[model samples]
Every structure is written in structure tokens, then in C-alpha cells.
Target: MSVGLTQPIWMEMALALLILPGVWCTSWLVLYQDVCAVRGSSVVILCTYHYPETLVNKNLTVEKVMWSHGRKQFFDGPFIIDSNNRTHTATKFEYVGNKVHNCTLQIHQVEQSDSGEYAFRFETNNGGKWTGSNGAKVNISELIISMTTPKVHGPIKEGDCVNLTCMNNCSSAVMWFRNGKPLQEESSTLYLCDISFQDSGNYSCSPKHHNRPLSEVIRVSVEYSPRNTSVSVWPSSEVLEGSDVTLTCSSNANPTLNYTWFKIDGDSCLEMVSQAELQFNVTHTGNSGKYFCVVSNKHGRQNSTILSLKVKDHAEGMAAVTLTILLAVLAVVPMIVIVPMVTWHLVAHRKKTTAPKPDTEENTQTTEVHVTSPTSDCSLTEERREEEPSQQDEVPYATVHITKQRANIQQQNEEATAIYSSIWEQQAKEDLYSVVSRPTPRGKQAQDDPVIYSTVFRQ
Candidate 1:
């Protein structure tokens, strides 16, 4: 009975020795539930362990300390931080805790792949191993900013409000940057009230903790109508006639404004053209008046000040008109006088050159013809060789002249009668032969009488 009782006691002692070391070597791990980190940044995972001091005094030494991600079970995931034989294995992971029980792991430039459940495992020199029951959770996110209220992209009108929000999983403060410069405000949301064209630029948001890997850049554009509408005329307002005049319209706007030329009529405006400039040749006074331009865009429209186009002065216009009239009169007066005078001279010259010549022979013959006796019959005759007159012959007319001469003789009856009778008898015999032969009347008797006869001839 003593030998059997001693065997039972030895068996119990052996079992108790195995259970005591296991209870002393037991460890408890404590860590944060979840850690959030940004890409391209570093993270610190703080961890602390608790174990009985009896293991340290029993010559039990820690051989290796390791950290792994992506698995809940021990030794199932790849090791990220490993300190074995007093040396670290991972280049990105570092053990930054005390050598006794703390296992703080620091990761440099943490990436998306480094985020997962991470657990700690430790080994002792006595071939004892322990893995923590709970692991630390890690989360990673990219930095992004977006316009929330507007719900639209760029090209917002001026004086409108804009709202921007920064999207990140980290608990760090959001910083707003305009054109790569930090703004005064710090928050996840940014408000821009009554924005203007100066606010248009590249905008981005980033966490204050991380300096690298900023959010994607967004562009903002402010659209507005033209401001400070101005109109300029070349060569000044006081222009001259027959000169080329140009009117230009200028303004400031976004998305490029469309220009329109207008002329201000009595109470309304007349649209002239759809161009930035209006150019034309000034001919008369009609082109001078009030004019302006309208600049417009999708946002709004603006009109320039009314510009007056004062053409040539009244005196200058009158002078030009008078000069034109004088030139016209000078050109026409000479033609009027010269043409009539030349025509009259030509008519007179033609008449003088075509007059007929007077004939000398016919004129002389008409002047010499005359009647010598009243009781005696006179006969005249003209003799010519040709029937038609020559070119050199002249027109003819007749004229007559008469002259008489008488002689007295005393009567001597007996002796003078006989002498006279013989003279008369001889004259009667000559007259009878000169006269035309004709029979005398039956009752008249022939008597011998004394008579005298006179005859004239012209050549």
C-alpha cells in the first residue's frame, strides 16, 4: 500500500509542474480598436502586454517579436515587423517599444495594402509561444474634395455661392488650398459667398497631418457680363467728310462676350452690326449722330456710354458746297458762250463764201437803153452766144432814160417853098423806101410833104 501511494504522488507532482509554467507564461494584449491612416503617411500602432513575473525569474527569455496583418489566427499571415536575434527584418515596419512587454509598431509611408487586422506573436527561449487573441484594425483612404451644394462643375456665375467638402477617413483637420497655397480657414467644409472672377483658380484639399498626396485639383470659373463698357472712335469725335471712320467696342467678360454695334435713334436704338468694330466711309451728314455698343454673354449684358459723332462743322460744309457750285458754273459758262459764238461765226462765213457774183456786161447794157421819140415805136434786142449763164455770170436788170431836142424854121412862101419842096420831095422819097412796104388806105391821096426824122442807137 505505501509503494502504490508514492507512485500516485509523483504523477500529481509532474502534472502540477506542467500546469504552473503554462499559467505563468500566459500574456494579455491591449491595443486600439481601429486605426485610420492616409496613404503616403506613417502610422503608429501602440500595444502593451501583461504577463506573470515568475516567467522572467525562471530564466525564460524572449527570443523573437513579430507583427502580421491579414489574418486572425497566429502564424497565418505574412509578418510585417519581425525582431529576431536582436535585429529587425521589415524595412517599412519598426519595433519602437520597450524590449520587455511593449510591442509598438511604426510603419513609414503606409500604403493601402498595409491596412488590415494586425496581431502580435512572441516566442520564448524555452520553446514557448503566444499570440494575442484580439488584433488591431487599420483603415486607409485617399484625400478628395468635391463641390456639394452646387452639384455642378466649373463656370458658375459671379455673385453666386459655392460649397466644398473634403472627403477623408482620417480624423485629421482638413486644409483648403487655392493655387497650391493654404487658406486661413480649416475644416472639412468650405464656403465661398459672393464669388468673383478673382476666385477662379485651381482648388484642392488635404489633411493637416499629411503633407504629401493632396486631393485632385479642381478648377473654378466665374462667368460674368462685360464691365466698364467703352467705345473709342479713331481720329476723334469731330470728323471730316469723305474720311474713313472706325468705331471700336471693348469690355471685360468671361467665356468671351459677343459685341453688337448700335445707333441711338430718337428714343430707341437701331442694331447696326454684330461685330466688335464698325467701319465705313463717311459721305454726308447722315453718318453723324449718337452711337453706342452692347456687349453681352450668357450671364448678362452691358451697354457703353452714348458717343456722339460730330462731323464737319456748318461753316466747313457751306464752304465745300459753295466751292462745288462755283466749279460747276465755271465749267459750264465757258461752254455756253463759246459754243454759240462759234456757231454764229461759222454761219456768217458760210453765207459770205456762197454769195453770187454780179455780171458787168448785163449791167452796162441796162444803163445805156433809152426812148428817143414818143410817137415813134422803139424796139430793143439782146444778143448772146450761150443759153445758160456761167458760174462767173451775174444777175441783170434794166433802166431807161429819155431826152428831146427841137429846131425852129421861119416860113418863106414862094421861093423858100420851091427850095423846101424839092428838099421835102427828096426826104419823102427816102422815107418811103425806109418804111415797111404796105398798101395805103383807099380813100387817102398821096401828097409830097417835107419831114425830118431823128434815130438813136446804143451798143
Candidate 2:
């Protein structure tokens, strides 16, 4: 099988030639060529040559070397530089390389007139005369940038518009740059509008071809008037009397600025240097009021908003500081006090929730009952009980709880009903007295202590 190539042989050779630097070579001669030269700069054309050591048994040797250019015939042209005579057409053309296979030539401060082809020649001891074919060729070019100048030829002021143009300024657009950084604009002529101070910088444009040089750098400057006028106070407003305080006024402006302070007294204006921006001190309440500053330049002037200046005596200042501290402490006191209380409550509640439940206590009741003979002092029952509540509860204070055991009256015969009716009639006239036995304290039994109490008998 035959291997195939992805590209043609000529295409591959052309790519290889592009990858290599400028060269002009023959069988016995070699020259290092410069693709182009920039005007006003130095350029070199490197060269080297060799011959067969033995040409027909007669050794070939070089005797003289010469360089020439600008005539119709390459070899017949007058030699600009000659090694044998040490002759040179101009000081700008120099022979830097030696005769030993090194024949470098350098031109200083190249000019447009230097744009031409240069060739080299040599004569050997064996009658060998040769000139390198089509020697180093040089092309000279220059970069230029231009812009429209305002009628007032000073620096461009803020908010001014301008048009910057490159040489040739072809119909098709090209890349534009500012301060070496590329801009989004693409035009041979770049447009700048509403320029600001930040827009001041160097600008240039790209060339049409990669081999061509970029345009020279051109600087653009923008000047601006005063803006963002403001006033600042040091040591704060509301300062104590006899305390040093400073007031400063500032603004953004160009061509320098002058600061002036003013006091707005009714309709009149008082001029002072508190606007000294860049100072005023207060001592008494007389210095307190609405004040302003004026920042100005030849371009224009701007004023700051009213600044309230307050000065107080030592007593008032101390009172204010003390009040602030007191309020701050008061505000924090509630949190400090409530935190422990809330923590205690939270601990109690959590213990209540997570701890074992406590057993409930049962209530005990004691009742003492006695008969008052159903006769004696029935009417005086309430009078005695009202005067003896403590005596009734000397050993134990407990309410008497009675559960009524009622008889079914509907089931009673006529005889039993008659007897109940007679007793209820007598009981309704007065309440019956009971003799209550007060209980002793814990571990002691009661010896029937008489505690008089009242009970109502109801039918």
C-alpha cells in the first residue's frame, strides 16, 4: 500500500517557507534579508559566502569584497562599500562582517532614499569573480496619526467631542485603541464624544496589513470644571465650647481651585475660611448656624448645601453625654435582669417537662356532729358561732362537710309524714346548735373539745 499526503507538495513547501525568516541563497553565497525597514531606524543585512576548497586543483581564495546598489546592471553599479580601498559612499552604509564567510552590512538612520536593492561581489586569487544574485531588498515605511484640532487649540475640555484619524483612513473600518488597550470601536477615524477626565489617554489605530506598522501614539487630554462640592466636619457637630473643631470644603476641579466659607445670616452672606477646606474652629454658641462653602475656578463655581454647625457649653455637652450613657444603660438593664429570670423559668419549665411527675396529694376532711337537745338556745346559735371562729379551730381548722341522707318522702305513709311536718315546723323557727369536737395537732388525739357551731335542719 502507498502512503498518502494530506496536503500537496507545493503547499507544504510554501508553508515551510512562511515558517522561516527572510533568506536569499545561491550555491556559493547566502544572505540574511530583512523583510522591511522603518524610516529613522537602523537595519542590518547579514551575509556569508563560501567556495570549493579545490577548484580543478587550484585552491579558490577571496582577495577583495565589494557592495553596490541602484544601477541598471547589478555588478556594474558603483560600489558603495569596498574592503580593498576602504571606500564608502556615505557614513550611513557600513561593512560590519569580515571577509571570512561573514559579510554583514548595516545601515544607520535609514531614509526613504535608502529604499533600494543591495548586492555583494567578490574576486578570488584564482580569477573567480562573483556577485550574489538579487541581494537584500529593503522597503521603508512610517507610522502617522492625526486628529482634528479645536479652534481653541488648548487641551480638550470635559464634555467635548473629537475625531481622531489614522493615515490613509481607508473606507473600510479598522481597530481603534486607547492607552494601548483596544476599544470596541472599529474605524480608521475614531470618534470620542462627551469626553471626561478619565478618558484622557494615548490613542492609536491598527494598520490595514499585518506587515504594516501601527500608527504612532497620540495623547488626548481632558480638562474639567469643579463638581461634587462637599463640606466635612472634624470632631463632629454639636461639639462642646472651647473644644477645637475643624470644617473642610472640597470639590473636583481642574486648573486648581479656591475654597471660601460663608455664613448664611438671614439674607446676607458672611465670607470666612471655614471653606478653607482644606478649617474653622468653634468656641461658643455664636458659631452655631447654617453655613455653606463656595468652590470656584476660572472655569466655573459651585456651592455646597447648608451645613448646620452646632456648638454647646461644657455643661450641656456633659449632660448630653451623660444622658446618652444613661439611656444606653437603661436599655441594656432590662435584658440583663430579665435574662436570668427567664433562664430560671425556662429551667423550671424544662425540669417540669423532663423530670418525673410528682404524685398528687389527696385532701382529708373531718366532720364533728352533736345534738343541742333540740331545745336549748336554738335562737342564739348564729350569735355564738359568729363570735367564736378562732376558738372553734384552736387545734385544727377544718370545714365540716356533711352529705345529706334524705328519706324518700313519697314512699312515707301518712303517719310518718305528719311527724316530719311537725318537727320541720319547729326547726323552721330556729337553727339547731351542734357541739363540734376539734381535732388535735399531728400525733395527738382530740379529747372531745367542745367547739360550738350551727347547722340548719331542712325538710
Candidate that would win on lDDT: 1
Residue 338 accuracy (lDDT) in model 2: 99
Q: Kindly report the root-mean-square deviation of model 1 from the true structure over all alpha carbons.
A: 36.7
lDDT of 2: 0.65
What is the TM-score (0 to 1) of candidate 1?
0.45
lDDT of 1 by residue, 146-213 (tens): 77435454568878888877888885487788888888768888888898998988888877755543
Q: For all candidates, what are the clash counts?
A: 1, 2
Error at 426, model 2, angstroms: 51
The sequence of per-residue lDDT tens digits that candidate 2 reaches over residues 168-272 is 312244567787777776656778888788888888766443322366788887777789988878878678777686777778887678888888898999887
Residue 155 error for model 2, in Å?
4.6
Cα-based lDDT at residue 357, candidate 2: 54
Which regions of candidate 1 are displaced past 4 Å? 1-33, 53-57, 85-91, 142-144, 149-154, 170-172, 226-253, 256-459
